[model samples]
Structures are given as C-alpha cells and as structure tokens.
Target: MNRTAQPAGTPVRSVPSKFRGPFVRWPRIADATLALAMFVAVTSLEEGPGDSLVVRPVVDLPPAVLLLFAAAGAALYWRRHKPLAVLSVALAAWAPMLGSSYANVGGIVIVALYSAGRHTQDRRWGPLGVVAAVGAVTLDGLLLSLPAGEIGFGCLVMLGAWYMGRRLRLRSERAAQLRQEQAAEAQRIAAEERTHIARELHDVVAHRVSMMTVQAGAARMVAAEDPQGALEAMTAVEEAGRQALDELRHLLGVLRPKAERDGLGPQPGLTDLPRLVAQVREAGLDVSLTDDIRAPLPARVELSVYRIVQEALTNVLKHSGPHTRTEVRLGHDQCGPGISIEVLDDGQGAALQSVSGTARTTGMGGHGIVGMRERALLLGGTLDAGPRPGGGFRLTAHLPVQPVLGEPA
Candidate 1:
C-alpha cells in the first residue's frame, strides 16, 4: 500500500481505507471492553450501615443503580468522536456513586478526559475538560468531608493524565512538520539535478551531431566529381560519430551511482579549443581562433567556457552554413577580473536568412542559447548573443576566475 506524503498541519485520518475491515472495528471493541470494566467496578460495591462504606457482591446492587453505572461506562464508546459531550454524560451518570463505597470509577473519568485532550480539534476544549473534571471531583470530595490534601492530589492526577495526552499530540505535530521539511528539500534538489543533467546532455550531443550531419551531406554532394575529397568528408563524419559516442559514455558514467562508476574521463576545457577550431575548419567553415588568457581558471569556469563556445560555433554551423566566415577569441576582460569570450560569424548563407526570418517573426533564441545563458548565470556571470551591427551574429560571455567554494578547483 502506497501513501502520498501529507503536508504539514494536514489532519491525518485515524484509520486508512485499506485497513477498514478488522482494524476499523478494533477501537469500538476496545472502548466496549473499557466500559464493561468500569461498569463492573462500580456495581461491585455496597454500603454496610449508616455512615459505613464497604464492598459487597454485584448481586446486592439495585437495578436502577446498575443501569446508571452501565450508562456512565457506555458513554465512553463515543469519546473519540464527541469527547466533551461524552465526558459530561459520564460525570452525570456517575454522580450517584460520588459518596458511596465504590471502587473509584475515576478510571472512566480519566479515559474521557484524556480522549478529550488528545482528539479535540479546538485547543480550548482540552483545558476546559480538565477544569470541569477537576471541579466535579473537588465538589464531590468537599461534600464527602474528604481531606484537602487528598482532594488536591486527585485533581493533580487528572490534570497529569490530560497533560500527557496533550503532550503526545504536540510531539506528533512536530514530527510531521520535520518530515514535510525534509521531503520538500529532497524534491528541490532532485529538480536541480535533473536540470543539470539535461544541460550536459544537450551540450555533449548537439555539436557533434551537427558536425556529422554537415560532413555526411558534403560527402554525398562531392562523391562523383572529387573521390578523394568525398573520402575525407566521410572520414570527418566517422570521427564526429566516434567523439559523440565517447562523450555520451563519459556522461553516462558520471550519472551512474558513485560505487559503480570508475575511470571516467575529465570534461573538455580551454586547452581543447584549438582541436575544436580545427574540426570546424575541416567541416569547411572559415574559422579562426586567438587565445590570450593569462591566468589559470577553475574547472567549472573552464567547462562552462568550453560548452558556451561549442554551442555558439554549433549554432553558426547550423544557421550560417559551412562556408560562412567565423572567428573565436578568448582573453581576460579588461574591465573586470574574469575571462571574456566572443564568437562572431558573418550571416550570409541561405540557412542564416531562414533562421533570422523566423526569429524576426517570433522573438526567441533556440534552447542551445538558453542553456548557454543558464550556465553563465549559475556561475554568477553573464552572456549576450545577438546579431551584430553590420551583417553577422555575435556571442559574448564573461566568467569570473575565482572558483565557487565547495566545488572542485
């Protein structure tokens, strides 16, 4: 049986629906047993002579007194549902035995008081029930000429039982609140982890797949006229496919449980940019790179920079075609203590016109750009991607050099 977690302060049902058969009947059976016990205790007593209290067999009790005791005990069956009302009825029915020599039917009173304190929804009822019970017991004691200390002790005992029930209720509420907080925190962390994994998958697969697609098309176009060039294009396609598979394997290894993962390769960093530029050139794009970074960067910043540049160049290939001119520049930010990156491409291809026309109609970038922006924001940095003033697309990103605390440096 599965049960969803309930929010804090939500009322919990006493009996779940699945156990509604025998378990549901147990409460009534227990109440009936308690009532029978109280009735037997009260009726098994008698008075000897005038002013003398004594115990006798149950057979000597009159029918009317027995009926009253039975009624008082039976009222306990509804204590959980109507606690205050049941307490009142039990008190009234037991009034006849107040000064008699009966085994204290105070057991019935105690049960009713505890139920009222534990089950009542309204806070005032518990204390009100306690006060009423104490007042009734105190009045009976005074009329019977009982000692003051004995009366006070009786009141304290009743108060203590009610307090125990109330204390249990409070502790249950605190436990429920703690569970709710922990469940909420777990859900929040799961959502963040899912988003991070999705971003990584996109960055890993998109660029490699795009390169393979372009190389395959070029191979098909030039197969008849230039056999050697067609062979080189097919080789590029094969290499792109292999790189994609390797990256995906590394990603899956990272996703596995820590105990099961071993020998995972490190992610791409700034040093891998030259290789990336070389591959883009082989795909026939006129791409150039100029690196001027002076200081070493944290691993996270390096990965983000690599992914951002990869996504940007992939976008250029996808939207601007393979023959478009592009430049990737990396250097330290002159105005701030961080690294700056820019990818500029002349948007002169038919593919570029089609994408630009669609964007002009509906103003939004693709998910690749959105993922790049999210990475920058996560590292407390910024990214800007848009069409340049003259006739090209431009993407610029600035990332701080300091590593975030608690992260691998």
Candidate 2:
C-alpha cells in the first residue's frame, strides 16, 4: 500500500511546562527583570558627558517623554506571547525615542523585530516586519538628519535578525517532518514481521496434522480384518502426533516474549528430509528422495527448502490416488546459478485435479501454494506448481544461492 503518513522517523512531542527550565517556566518574570535593568542603565547615564562613547541626551526629555521610553522597553515582556503586538507598540513609540536621541532604546526595537520573525506563527508577519523596518529607517533619516549609509546599515541589521529567525523556524519544521517519516517506517517493519511469523506457523501445523488425519483413518478402516496392520497404523499415528507436537512447541517457543522463553531449539533443515519422507511413508505413501549438491546451504535457504518439500509431500498424501508414486529431486546446476527442487507424483490425475480445484477455492485454499511462493521470493527465488504434461503433478522451485553457496561446481 502507498504510505499516507511519514515513514522512518519519530513523532515530535511538545515539551511539558514542568521541564522548561526555571527561566522559561516564568517568562514574564524574566522579561520584567530585563526591562528593569534597561530602565536603570538608561536613567543612570551622565547628562554632562563630553564627546565620549556614552550617547548624551540630544534634548532634555520631560517626564512624559521619559515615560514613553520606559513604556517601550517594558513592552518587550510580551514579545514571545504577543510578538506582533509588542512590535507594533515599539514602532508607535519609535519616533519619540529617536527624536529624543535615546539611542539605547533602539536596542529594544531590534530585539522586538527579532522576536516577531522568530515566534509569530502567522505568515502576514513577514511583510509586516519588513514594513516596520522600512518605516523606522525613514523616520530616523528624516527626523535625525542621519546619513544614508547609517540608516541603510541600521535597516540591514534589523532585516538580518529577522532573516536568522525565519531560517531557524524552517529548520525546526524540517526536523519534525523527518521524525514523522521515521515513525512510519518502524510501524511498517513491525507489520511485515508479524506476517512472516504467521506464514511459518501455517507451514509447521498443516503438514503434520494432514498426515495424522490420513494415518488415523487408515487404522480405523482395517482394525478388525487385519489386527497387525491396524496396530502398525496406530503406531504411525502416535509418531506423527508426537512430531507435530514437538515442532509446534519449538515454533511457539520462538514466538514467546523474550523474557518468558528459555531459548530456541534447532529449526528443520534440508537434512531432515529423510525423517520427513519416512513419516509420510508411514501413512502408506511411497516417496523417494534424490540429492546431488554436496555443498552446505545457508540456514534460511535450507529452511525454505525443507518447508517446501514438506508441504508438497503433505498435499500428495492428502489428495493423490491409491497407487501414486512420488519422487523428490534436489540439485544445483553446474552451468547456472542457485539450487533447484522438484516434487513429481504419478497418480491418477487426482493430485493435479486437487491443485486446480484448490486454486479456485476462496480463502481456505491456495494458502499452501502462497506460503511456498513467499518463502522462495524472500530468498530471490521462483516457484511453479501445476499438472505435469504427461500424467502427474509437479512442483518446482529455483532459489538463488550465489550469495550463500558461492561459486557453483
């Protein structure tokens, strides 16, 4: 399915107020302290200053004008909470502050411009901030008789702060998107793992149970007429049941939570085919195995081969005619790459008919074929199962082994 949300990232959660550090949790208090410091620093400047760095008051400010300057500095307390409103208030009082030559208060205007760009969520803030910068520069140039270079440089400084704030906002948004993508990928992987487990369970349970059913029925049919044959049939039934229980327990152990499971035992592999063939023989089916590849197969490839052969044998026992003879062949071609497997059955077309009929059955059928195909595809392989051209059923699989088995002989 196509992804509807981001993948491969974690979700960004909002930071709780309790963990925002002391200053962030009480922003108003922090702003008040900063405003008080600015007020004291401005008021304490020496009025009879010579041509020193300390900017002397150009005009002696009355109490009213002094109050306006103090008000502009205090308005910074709400810059983060109401950045647009704070900037507007600072701009309203900008002319008076410049006219009185309160250069220190210009620092407050620069700070307000930075906060407006950085914190304002509204898109309109961008053009509004530019307008505020242009208006401030024009007023200062006209009223204070400042040179063009000085006014231009001052405007550039305000714009630079605004640009930096905008850049930071974009960076934060990108990080959030990446986190979302990562989260989606994690969920997808989990779902795929679950499906793989379910397929394995089906392969383990179905083969053993089908054999048990055939053996039990044969024993019941011949019990009175042939007592010795019935005893042997019952014994085969017992063996099939035990083997099924053992394999089921092993798979269940792997599925248990890590803390609860003691450990995992060995999984079935190609070497176990002899025992598997013997078990099917107990159900009165004649089966033969042939192998030519001398090299060892990788664990995954070996497991898939074992399960494929097991499922094919189970199907033959369940649906083949009374006189069917089955043969299993395993080999690696020297001229090509990968391993090849084929299970052929010479029956009265019963196995072939079952395969075709099962394909059309909804839900219940086709799972065995689908499971085998899934295993082959996972290891870069292909599978084909259908009626043989002459008179029987054939299932074949070609699984690539170059990465695992290396060069062919």
Candidate 3:
C-alpha cells in the first residue's frame, strides 16, 4: 500500500513510537488472517463466465481467479502501513476478472479502504472505484445483452461491507484521540498545581529565612558583651532557619510525580504551648498563659490553639514595644463544643505595627497572622482580631474540637 508519510501534521509518530505503534502499525497475524478469509470467501462466491456459459474444461470453467485473490489477501498485511501499494495490488488482482460474468467475491478491498480512509476522510473512493468498475463490467455484459440485476447486487454487497468497516475504524480512532487528550489535560493540571505551591513557599519561607538571618546577625553583634544571652539567641535563630529549610524541602519534593512528603513533621498542638511560651520568654518577652480544658481534645483542635497562640505572641514581639505586657487565655468545657484562644497585649491596640515588615496584619502582605486564621478555618473555627473593648489589642480564635467525619446521622 501507499506508505506515503503524512506531512508533519500527521498524528503518526515518525518512527513508530508509543504514540503511533498500536494505532497505525498493522499486526502481521491479524492482517494475514483477514486477508486469507476475505480472499477465500469472496473468490468462492464468483462464478466464472465459462461456468455460466457451460464451457468445457472444469479448470477453465471459471477464471483463474483464486490465484489473484490469494495475492490480494496476502497484501492485506501491509495495507495500513503502505496504503497506495496495497490499493494497487488489490486493483491489479480484481481488474482482469471484471470482464467475466463473476469477479472475485471476497470483500478484501473494503478492509484496505477502511484503513486508508481512517487516515484521510476520502474513504468513499474505495467503494466508488468498485462501483465504477462494476458499472463498466455491467456495460460490457450489456454489449452481449446479459443480465444486470445480479451484477448490481454483488457490487452493493461489497459497498455494504466497506461501510461497516469504516464505521468500526472511525470509532477506534476517536477513542484513541480522547485518551491522548485526557492524558495531556491531566499533565497540565499537575503542572499548574506545582507552580501555585512553589509560589506559596517563596512567599512564606523567604520571610522566615530573612527573619532568622537578621536574628543571627543581631546575636553575633552582641556576643562579646553578653555571651550566654547571645548563645541562646543564636540557637533560636538556628532552630528557626532549620524549620524553614525543612518546609522548603517538603515543597520541592512535591514537584516529583511520585515522591511523597513526610509533611513538616507533626503539627504543633496545645501541649507545645509551654515550650512556645518559653521560646518567646527567652527572647525577652514577659508572657502569662492560662489554660482550662478538662476533657480530651481532638488533635486538630489542639493544633489550631497552638497556632493561634504562636502567631499572637509572634505578633506581640513584632508589634508590641519592648516593655509591652502579654497575656494568653485558653479554655474549653463539655458544653463549649470547641476551644477558644484569647491573646491580649497592652501595646499596639490593633494598629499592629509592620514591625520591620515581619508580621502581616489583617489588611497587609504579611502571612503570619493570616496563617493563624487559616488554621482556625480549617478546624471549622472563627478568628477575631482588633482592639479590645476596654484597652489593649486582642486576637481571639474559637475552633471546633469534635470532628464531624462520619456518615450523616
């Protein structure tokens, strides 16, 4: 058949890649079998002109049509891969028999037509050629004044078979195209998600790293004057930097298709309160904390509480002047249904200072405060930040402790 390569716009890969192999490359066994069956079935149905006219020799009764059919059947193997060549072979085999009362019977050319038509929309030509040749044969028989309906019936039979093959091939091609499109769309979605996450990391981690760097510089500058104090401050800065690096690695690992993240370790819970308070106290803030929770708390609830308090205190340091007063209140009860956090400070009454551009307040670019609110919402909670009714600034976070993770009751 014609192996004429389609132009660059062709869907077939240049050399039989995964993209084109299964779809375009005709299989040897299937080709050979189809060719044989079609040739035998079609040729057997033909009644040579000699048979119709009662000629003498049995071998000469009908045309030596089986030989031509055999060659056409074998040629089916390469039809899809080389359509022009296969089409030529099919025509050559069927050409001579057209003048006979009966032409080779098998509908082999229809299969080749289907294969070629799938590549181009011009599938009608296969049946057209058959019809035109049959018409010529019918006309030649008319010069002899022979029957016409029988020849017309044979031509219609071939056309019907060709139509069926074309439908089946079209369906197969559509399914393959849809599969390819779906795969491409999935890749696009994944790439977009990666880009979004990378951007979030750049905004969050970059800020933390900058803070750590600044603190480290401060510690080094004060080391000679206050050795033990400088040591503690440097250690805190080191810990902060290490945390940022770990989170950065987690985000980067997400870019890998199959790699899984260990997630930034376990998220901090309420049990971390004392340690967190101490970390800030060591940094020269005076903090008083109160807690009251008699019942066992859910993990997510405890995590939200820790984050709210952590961000609140971080803000106090960032916004409150050096001598500001800080107080934390956490409470829960059987009837409470959730937990609440109250952080109040005598300094910075909701006009939270940019504090060297470290903390982001309600309406600014900073993420620390926004992160606290996000944690609250994730736990089905609410956060209120503004000036206290009486005086100092306050941040109150209320979060559900009971998970609603079951079938509707």
lDDT of each: 0.74, 0.69, 0.62
Evaluated against the true structure, the overall lDDT of model 3 is 0.62
**lDDT of prediction 2:** 0.69
Alpha-carbon TM-score of each model against the true structure: 0.51, 0.47, 0.44
Order of the predicted models by lDDT, top scorer first: 1, 2, 3
In the range 246-309, model 3's lDDT, one tens digit per residue, is 7777666664222124454565777789999888888667789898876777776776687678
Evaluated against the true structure, the overall lDDT of model 1 is 0.74
Clashing pairs in 1: none
* Ten-residue region with minimum lDDT total, candidate 2: 9-18
Model 3 residue 262 CA deviation in Å? 19
In model 2, state the lDDT of residue 224.
86
1-409, model 1: which lDDT tens digit per residue? 0011222332222112234553247878877777777777667754467735566677876777777778778888888788888878777765666765552567788888887777676688678878877887887788778899989998998898788877876887887777687445434444566788999999998899999999999999999999999999999999999999999988998865342367666777999988888887887788899999968889999989888887777777777778889989999988889988888887775454566434521123225554565678789887766566566777778889888998877
Q: Across residues 62-118, which tens digit of lDDT does each residue of candidate 2 receive?
A: 677678677777888887888888787777766656644454466667778777877
Best by lDDT: 1
